[model samples]
Target: MNKLLVITVLVALLALSAESFRVPRQAAAEEEEGTLARITDTVKSYYEQSVNTASNYLESIKGMKLEEKAKNLFEETTKAVSTYTGILQDQLYHIFYPQN
Candidate 1:
């Protein structure tokens, strides 16, 4: 009877330990998801800002001198394209070689 009781207690303890381990695992997963969400939001904001700046610059260009307007448009378009392209390339790189 004593042996049986010891075995039962051991089994119960093992079960409790196993259940306890899950909480940390779940928390870690939640933390990771939160971090990913923040990163996604930041990237989205960057893209939106870049787009807004480009649009505003183009819209305002009509009032400027022809040569100056052309130069401004070229500079703004180049900068926006480069910024977005860099973001795309980084995403592609990560997709192709995901970090473990």
Candidate 2:
């Protein structure tokens, strides 16, 4: 478990390192067009990869089926929403009834 967690963290860090590449400091005219194109293309590819990663993750979650687990999750989510709603109501009441 620990090894898997460490590997996942390392992979995530490495994934982010793709975006941290320093663009050439040279003037645009001085930099080769191919080099500029490569850098831009790499950034675009990484952006697409990140978006696909998120889309895939969402699809996985949407595809999951565990009725019992989902029931529990729904109940918990309902309680959370109720709690937040009550808090908001209290704040609104306080705003209207500042003396209270």
State the weakest 10-residue window (summed lDDT) of model 1. 17-26
Question: What stretches of model 1 exceed 4 Å from their correct place?
Answer: 1-64
**Which ranges in model 2 have alpha carbons more than 4 Å from their true place?**
1-32, 66-68, 72-100
Kindly list the per-residue Cα lDDT of model 1 for residues 1-100, writing each as its tens digit.
8546655755554454343334453355444444445555565566567769988998777656778878999999999999999999999999999999
Q: How big is the positional error of residue 37 in model 2, measured in Å on the Cα after superposition?
A: 1.8
In Å, residue 72's CA in model 1 sits off its true spot by 0.3
Error of 2 at 41 (Å): 0.5
* Per-residue lDDT value at 61 in model 2: 81
lDDT for predicted candidate 1 compared with the true structure:
0.69
Cα lDDT over the full model 2: 0.72
Inter-residue clash pairs, candidate 2: none
The alpha-carbon lDDT assigned to residue 65 of candidate 2 equals 57
